[model samples]
Target: MKHLLNLLAAIALLVWGTQLVRTGVLRVFGANLRSLLARSMGNRFSAALSGIGVTALVQSSTATALMTSSFVGQGLISLPAALAVMRGADVGTALMAVLFSTDLSWLSPLFIFVGVVMYMARQDTTTGRVGRVFIGLGLILLALRLVVETSEPLLASPVVRTLLGSVSSDLVAELLVGAALAVISYSSLAIVLLIAAMAASHVVPTEVALGLVLGANLGSGLLAILTTLKASVEVRQVTWGNMVFKVLGVALVAPLIGLWLRHAHPRLGDIATSVVLFHLAYNVVISLGFIGMTQWVASLMARLMPPADPASKNPLRPRHLDPSALATPSLAISCAAREALHQADLVEAMLVGMYTVIRTGDLKLSAELRQIDDSVDELYSAIKYYLTKISRSELDEREGRRWTDIIGFTINMEQIGDIIERVLIDIEDKKIKRGFRFSEAGMQEITELHGRLVDNLRLAMSVFLNGDVRDARRLLEEKVRFRDLERSYAAAHLARLSDRTVPSIETSSLHIDLLSELKRINSLLCSMAYPILEPTGTLAPSRLQDAAPARPQS
Candidate 1:
């Protein structure tokens, strides 16, 4: 029982290590990795290469599939290209299995020691996340070594002997058990490693281990399918196409196991090496053979799952706040950031609508703008609530900062929405209902300021999205220019008032209030730049310049 418990703990350690690597790599390179997949999809071959590269880094093909399919959901990549990427993801997993099966136990303690020092020293930076990846790799190696050592004692028990004996002759039963383990664990890489460890201990024959490897591959495909069931048809097509390749590969390989054992058994040496090699060979054959068939399979998957009805989509529904992503902090951060962008999109529409109301004095436009503000509020609530579910324990230092950034942006957006609603209301009551018209100069000032506000809103969104320091500084400069512009424009209005211009006299209150509100909007939009700037020391802590002591007048 102690040995069994140790074996189980070792298995648990393997899973935990795999998860650490997945989440850490994502926290460090998630956006860049997605960008690589997106840009590489120009051809199936390139896309496949990207899949292999990304999966190798992430250590989980499941993460690769989810990320790739999301692009498909957005129409960023075609289904065939996505299917190709998934094939490469499978090949990538096979390659990692081969690499891990060898003897690298000597590096385990070294990695853990260096990893702990790096992570502790720089917990909030990119270095810390890289250290995290190292730690996970070390744990995985140590756990695999433990599994082999502990599993050996279990072989002496008759109960364990009898359990192995029942499946020793039955390949199909082994296959089913392998698939089930892969699905339950949500990681074929971990399962494949576990199977390799067991085979090294002589708990299973070489042929039986190979069958389990094939089943793990199949379970990986099923995992993608079950994961994206609620996803769009474009995404579902990619998973279905990938599944077809896996199923076909398993069917063809299952029959040849006996022949393979007879001929290849001697060259393979030990049972563990043979199991991993067979696993690699199986994926290599399928990846090479099926790479050309992606287009045809893509067509079949398309027919199997047609595009969803246009009417089924709710325009106000959250596009990027995926519930399942909450398990992974980096993924959840991406989802929340994207949803915040969606919120900004609604806010942008409101900005445009408010301009139309002010320009044409159209009272009807105010109602439509109000409704848009409501949508912005709705999105703000959804994104905030979604982010709240992510556990604090899951976040490292850098991710913690990013989480706050997203929350801050969403809150700013919600306030911007309220301000827009108020601006619309002021327009309706003070200007439109009262039937007042601005002087030509006054109207021109409003138009010019409104145009600049819209442009700065776009700029602020870019700065928020990219975190570019140059752009952040530029945004701050514009805030100063805008404040000056408002002051000058207000003085011009007063000059016209002194001239007793009829239009200025009739619309003085609304024109002055309109300029003030636009300045408020610009300030809110520019606040996003402050977070980007403060770290660089480029922005002063207090804008109030130090008042120099009065020079000695004495």
Candidate 2:
């Protein structure tokens, strides 16, 4: 009972290590990794290579699937290309299994020691995150060693021997056990390593280990499907296609396992080596065989899970907020950031439509535009709720600050939507209903200001997404320029009023209100810059130069 408990504890440690490594690497290089995957999709082969490289670094094919599926969901990559990337991801997992199966016990203590020193010294910096990765690596190695050491004692027990004998000849049962272990562990790599350790200890036969290897592969596919169960149709389709490949590979390879084990087992010299080699060979063959068939698989998956109706009313539902990701704070933050950008896109659409409404004086268009704000409101609510679900305790200082920034950016976006809605109402009630029009000069001023406002909004989004200090600085500069333009436009409108220009005099109140509201919207849009700039110490304490002292009142 004690040995069994130790084994289970070791297995749990392996899973924890895998998760720590994954999340740590993501926190440090998530955006760069994403960009690498996105840019490498120029061709099918390159896309597959990128997938393999990324999955190897992150140590999980499931992470690769999520990233690829997101690109497909955004229409950035085609379904077939995404399917190819997943194929490479499987091979990457197989490679990791083979690599970890080697003897690296000597490095475990070294990694943990160095990792602890670096992490404790600079817990919030990139170096600290990299140290976290090393710590996870050390734990993984140590866990494998513990699994081996603990399983050795089981060999002496008659009950363990009997249990092993029962499954030695039953390939299907062994395969099922392996798949179950993979799902339970949330990592096929860990399961494969565990199987290797067990085979080396003679607790499991070489043939049985191979069967479990196949099961582990199938289990990983199932894991991806289950992980993305609540994702969008496009994402589900990607995982489903990958799952079909695994099922087919397993079915075809199950019958030939006996023959290959008999012929190849002796030459490999040891059971662990034979098992790892078999696992690698299986993935390589499957990758090569199915590399060209991604298009067909993609089409079949699309048929199985058809795209959602384009006119569906619930378009505001959160697409990127995978509940599974909430366990990894960095990943959860990324999802929130992406959804916030989606909110910004909706706001941009409304802003563009407002200009058209102003020019055409179309009350019907204004009414339609007002309905669009409902979608914006729904998205804002969804993002806020999703962000609140992230556990604050799990977040480090940098991640905590990022969380705050995302909240502030989204709040500003929601406020901009409300301001635009108000402006539309004002146009409908004050300007359109009274059939009042600004003079030609006044109309030109509004158009120019609106164009600049739209441009500034886009820049603000770029700053939010990239956090480029230069762009943030430039955004602040534009804010000043915008304020000056607003003042100048107001002065010009007043001068026109002083000249008693009939059209300007008639629409004076509406013109002034419109300019002021636009200026307010620009202020909200540029607010995205402050969070980015303050972190880098590039933002000033005040936006004003020193002013003269106030004189006493008379």
Candidate 3:
């Protein structure tokens, strides 16, 4: 009972320690890492190196993989680049196992103490995250210490020693045990430490420990592999490449196991060090071997997972609506908000494109605008369905607020799309039918208003992405200014409408309708930014306020 209790305590410590480390690392550098990964697209070597470096620093490949997938989904990193980075991450994680081989008990508490002070007292986000990393490190070390202590008694148990001995004697058995240990813990470092502890207690032979070490290597690649399953084929290839490299390394190194045994005892500390060394060696070798071969790998992956036909590529597909995502309501909400924002951006772009075609009187460009409008409608449907699904779940305070923001923004974007499709598209198409053209000054006024609106929308997106309330407020101010400019433009259009000699009916009528639609699009686009800027009240008709309170003189 006492032994069982000790084992349970050790298990509990291991779990807590890992949690502390994982959480701490994410808290400190997750956003920074995410930003970095986002900009690492198109370069496989760079992404792979980044992956390795981050995993080394954070001490967890799972964290690296999770963040990597999110980046991939955001179109931050190309699939191939993500794969290459994952390869490096696999090797980087070995560094953590190496640290555990040394006596780290003394430093653990210090890291925790410093980490806590920084996390609690520091105003700088980067500094606070760094503190979290240290605190998590402390917890991981403390857990290992407890786990090691609990397993020490097993060394004296003849049955335990004999059982471990049998598994160690055969290379295949050792490999299987090592892999099994990793799977059971769902952590390569954990299994490696366990094997190290067993070896230190002389319950497992050197050869067996080495074989288990190889198995742990294979197991460590599992999380990356699983993460890549839903990712692009290029990503899938990178993960497969990493797995193949590790599996082959184990196979290639198997014969050399005897040499390793002769040079080193299978002591817990030694085995732990070996695991780290092997991890580093594997990554260094694979990265060197595959660095320049990214294109070749990309080709193979393409052949295996062919790109979807352009005709079949639905730009309006809602990405964050994966049922698996719903399991984490907060993450789901965040994802939904991101998708909604993406749809809004598409509509904004289409509106600009349509205006461009209208200004240039480019018939080819007008056709393209119609296609963009079609896509906008598809995206609107996708967002509506996605939000409906998201609304089905129970929501906490922050989540509820986020849901409201996404739904509000999505509806606003949908309205903008409707304006473009139903109003703008109609006017542009009618102009083509009537063979009408706006005067240069008329086109210029409409273009300027759109330009200002796009600028404000850009600011709003930046504010949302950064969560800068101050910036969001600044955007609100800009929206008010743009509203004033819009009123001035509208008045001028109406004045022209009153002048029968100013233009022909077809051009004048289209111009009048066009200006109204532009204002509506601008207002809706501004509304997206308003929710974050002034959540309590509607964004009233501030544009009308700056007008001379009358139409412009004819």
Candidate 4:
């Protein structure tokens, strides 16, 4: 029972430590990481280097891969460019093996201290949050080192050795153990560290450790496939490309165990060092050899998966609200926020389209705008449902407040959708029935006003995604501008109404309704930015409160 308890303790520590690293180090930097990849994606070589560097620092290729996949989905990066980055990310992830082998475990305590100082004392600064990430990573590494040491004695027991060591000599046996370790970790890098430590202690032979390395590579594809589960067919194809490369690499390399042992580059230092070298070499070889075949692989994936149905690409419903994401509430919140922002952007775009259709009196354009509004409505519904599920979880106070804000924002946008359907579209019906026409000047004013509101909406969405209170405040200021514009424009129309020689009745009536709808749409756009820029539902009270609102606005 005592032994069982110790084993359980080690398992718990392992899981807890991993969660800290993921949420703290990986997630905190996710947006910056995304930006870095986005900015560096002009060429395959640059994209590859950026992918490797970012993944190495973040210590999670899955995160890097997901970000790259999203960029590809957005048409920010070409398919070939994304594939290169994915290839480089595999190599970059091997750095984790080297990190585990280092004597950096001693710095874990210092990391925690610095993290606390940055997180608590300098909460408003990116530098401080970055410090917190280092702290989390340091503590996690320390915990992993301790767990391995505490569990070392298990290797000496006959029952344990027999269970663990029975297959050390068999190639298939070693491969299975390696794959299992990867699944347990969800990181090939972590598994490599484990294998290295075990090999150093002579708990497992060098070849067995090497086989595990191969298996770990294959295991990482699990995450890629899972991420693509809800994505478009192109994303699925990219995922398959990831899988095929890793699987084929493993199949070819694992069978050459004897060759690697005899001819692979020799290493200095201990077995851990040798393991690191082996892991690095493996990834580098795969990347260099596979570079030329990128187009071929992409074509094959396209052939196999094909393109997604146009209808299926309509709106987003988050699968991230799953139990898996809920286990890490912080990560789930980030993903949910991303989805919400996506929905908000769709709403803003639909509004702009509606304004164009109404102003120009274009029937074809009106039909297109209506379709977009419907799509936005679908996305809004999906995001709201996902948030409702998230609200049931045990969130930290700050996260709870954010949930309230996002839910409110979604509801507000849904109302905007209703307004478009009921009110704005009705204007079109009237225009068709009454042969109403807007003056050329009236049309220009409405279009320009719509542009301003759309700009505010886009700015607000950016603030929400980045959590930039200043930008949010700037959006609010623009809302005041919008109000002034609304008042001035309405006054101008009334002056025209008072003239004895005014335009036709149909033109005057059309101008009146268009201005009213424009004002309403602009108001909603301003309201959407309100929560993000001022979480309390009011304008930001001070610059010091840069952190997103801590409570829901009434």
- Highest TM-score among the candidates is held by which one? 1
Q: Please give the lDDT score at residue 508 for candidate 3.
A: 69
Ten-residue stretch with the least lDDT total in model 1? 322-331
lDDT digits (tens) for residues 153-263 of candidate 3: 767778876787677568887777777666566677767766666556555665677678778767767655764566544445555655666665677678876765566
RMSD after CA superposition, every candidate: 4.5, 4.8, 8.6, 8.0
Residue ranges of candidate 1 with Cα displaced over 4 Å? 23-43, 117-131, 156-173, 205-208, 266-269, 308-342, 382-406, 430-445, 465-471, 484-513, 543-554
Encode model 1's per-residue lDDT on 1-554: one tens digit a residue. 89989999999999988988888888788778988998998888899999999999999888888888877776788989998999899889888988888999998998898888989999767898889889999999999999999999888899987887788768788878888989898899999999998988987777778888988988888888888787667877877788899888988888988988888867878777788888878887788889999999988987888886779877767788765455456667878999999999889889988888887987777898898888888899899998998876567676787899999999988998999999889888888898887889998898899899889989989988899999998898999999999999999999999999998998888888888988998999999998898888887668576996878876
* TM-score for each model: 0.83, 0.80, 0.65, 0.69
As for TM-score, the candidate ahead, 2 or 3, is: 2
Give candidate 2's TM-score.
0.80
Model 2 misses residue 3 by how many Å? 2.6
lDDT comparing candidate 1 with the true structure = 0.86
Candidate 3 or 1, higher lDDT: 1
Residue-level lDDT of model 4, residues 278-350, one tens digit each, is 7887788778788667788888887888786667753544432333333334545666777777677767767
In candidate 4, stretches whose alpha carbon ends up further than 4 angstroms from where it belongs are: 1-8, 11-19, 26-29, 116-120, 123-128, 262-269, 309-374, 385-409, 420-554
